[model samples]
Target: MNSRIVLGAFALTALVACKEKENKNIVEEIIEIEEVQPTTYAEISVKEGGSWKEGTREYIDGSFVNVDEMEVPEQHTDHSWYIRYEGPGWENKQTAYRLYLDWRNAIDIFGKKVDTLVLPYVGTDGFDSYHNEAPWGQDILKAGQSMGIGGYGRFTGDTIAHFNEVEKTHVKVDNSNSSSSVTIDYKGWKTGDVTTDLESVISIFPEDRFLKAELTPSVSFDGLATGIVKFDDIPLMQETSETGEWAYIATYGVQTLAGENDKLGMAIFYKTDEAKAIEGPHDHLVVFNPSTKTQTYYINSAWDQEKGGIKSEEAFKKDLQTKLSELDNNGKLE
Candidate 1:
């Protein structure tokens, strides 16, 4: 019953014609903006949920007045013992996720828009506990694949190093793109001989069940580990592209917002273009062996109660397939 259904589950380019290559100069002059702006953002975070109003804008994170702004606290109001920062997070109408400054890289699960646009800022209302939402939801990322629970790790051919100690952590919010992005920088830590300075940029779009994660290690290493919280009795269903191009690993069923063994799904979609292979040092492992140091993957969680009816394995699998297809065509033009 302590299950936290992590539904973090929630970018792009341009195309030009060969014939238009010669007219590049003219096109650049005509197109001043170059790209379209995102309409939706997690710009509103509320402490006292009510009619959206304006104030001095309490914290740097309390932007847009109504919600989703980061503000500097007048006093040290964050009372979370296990968590320190004001929970720099991003969300859409469907779901939300936050960071804990206490070492672990797992996300706090906030299923369903409590008040549609406002999320009661954790530290503001003197609410200082852990990730378990009172009646809202529970912690979601069960680390279904590996025990890492979406944490960063360095895996040699034989050994694995998970940086569980925190020297310091930096969390910030960015809305400069088509989607709202929360960047977490876990700096100055070590696991055995290898020290990992890792940065994870998680982007939550307007209406997405999954978030895209671009993880860059400050140092070179072998394989990077990305995984779901592995549960024993729940079981897992993983798939790999026959071409060795990508891998999809996920779980559904009984994993709901209320921990009712309903339909809640979590997954990691890894692109293996430059990968050696999606090797597993453990049963819960979803290792990505990238040709480069930067490893990119998609992480998401889905709740049946949060959305319409995505709480079953069959429906969840269908959604995962669509997500994988979208990831497969992320760059190329139709």
Candidate 2:
């Protein structure tokens, strides 16, 4: 009887040890999965080991080098090729975007065909190689003279004024496991008689294609606005969320630079009370009210070629409605 009792005790101890080992293995697996998960990123790659010309707006004899922050040179402008992709770019698994970082100050989209971080390899082959389609993606928007998607500007009555008159511009990038952001400081921005400093933070998360922009001006002034570029063939669609606190101006059609057959959808979500919808010469403008406080808005794009992307106008509208409902219920997107 004593031997049997001892054996029973030993068996119980062995069972307990096995259970603990099982739990430990489960915890380790969870940790390993978390460690390998993909994340968002932001960066600025500039031409290094080179010097700017004394009298011309050119960067001479340098290779491209990545940096965390940069001050826009006085001579940097569109097609100057001083910066890779012409500015700072940020990306999540779903989408990517870059700012012109020069006088154009326009935002452009990079439509991804795969769900991986690809900005580091972009523009590495050539200055304008992103214009053509590759295995990853390409510069999908023609921006032209427009603000691109949700780029900010001063709505000068019938037109929009870009960052052409800023005294100085500085850009910095921040990245984390869950999100990434680009912060730009525009100093001494002049529009007609008004000159004020503006700081803009554009951020993206790991799961969504929409990017949030928070704009804070040093002083209150009218005409502060953001918008989606206008195409002659694509009609503008507007809708207010159920709560009427948020609204969006969107466009859907084959407007991508990839090709004529590639369809794209773009939208700008804004607070109803803070901004009024208006039509500008080049964009569908959301003109904000005069206020010194920071203003918040969102920009998003849907490409037909993206993985499980919105392929039809009906589906795109449904997705937009779902996003609107989310904002109405939560006052923010997840």
Candidate 3:
């Protein structure tokens, strides 16, 4: 009875969510820009040797805002924290991933100054394919991936966190291309060993004003109650609606603590945005080793329709094998 009620509520939410039409003026809704000025560029220093092409505009509060579109240089790597001095330096005003003032203490921990840290920030927002997860979703209030690190904006009152006894912070600045981005490598910290974690809502590409489809890729505390375990390989399909646009997304990739290594795989799919009705054949595949629990989602991005779908599952398997071998060689897999 409890399961049935949960399913009923879930179904109702899904129905209600799909009922609303997508307003075409999505940009107008999110960017609260009073005036749309021509783009310009600024050079800002991010401590971890990461450089960004950022832009600034005066916000309603009269503070200059770094238009949140900073682009990290393609070659920039080597740090996990990012910080940018948009208006000026830390003493003036800046934004960061983890900032702490034991300044030298931060250097000892993150191997750099506490002021110029860069954290990885990847969002699949705005794009039709990646609009409902992580960087794009409100549900990502905290890390699906956690650490011994805790507390943000604690002492000294900046966007900083003290982790592993290290104080950290971030900053963002304008880049040369008139765009904005930050850089931080996915280093430091193990894969973690907690047996179970929960992702209440998963989204790939999220909008601040829309209810996107939610998915639970891994077995979750909630998904398990209904006997739906091991949902890690589901493809995020782009299906078309009657309203003349392709919609629907599944985001959030959770993993059982024990099944983390078994849950490795890639997603293969087409990059085109062509619309397809509900009855269209599958355009993606997720090949996996059920025993080992490794899987990859493959999308048919080629123009050659004949070489797509499960017909190419064998090829995908070979690819997965090669990847696994490499990972094993690197001693990255458990």
- Give me the candidate number with maximum lDDT: 2
**Candidate 2: pairs in clash:** none
- TM-scores for all candidates: the values are 0.65, 0.89, 0.19
Give a tens-digit lDDT track for model 2, residues 1-334.
1101221243454445556665456545555544544467788889988888878887887888777788988888877779989998878888899988887788999999998878878988988899999999889998989999999999989889998899999988877666778899999999999999999999888787899999999999999999999988899999999879999999999999888788999999999999999999999999999999999999989999997778999999999999999889987774
Q: What is the model-wide C-alpha lDDT for candidate 1?
A: 0.53
lDDT agreement with native, every candidate: 0.53, 0.86, 0.22
Model 1 superposed RMSD (Cα): 11.7
Could you give candidate 1's per-residue lDDT for residues 99-173 as a string of tens digits? 443334444455652424234343444434324554444445443223333445556566445545546556555
Sort by lDDT, best first.
Answer: 2, 1, 3
Highest-scoring model, TM-score: 2
Candidate 2 off by > 4 Å:
1-37
Residue-level lDDT of model 3, residues 228-325, one tens digit each, is 11143544433322332222222223322222331212222211132111211221111111121211111111010111222243454444344334
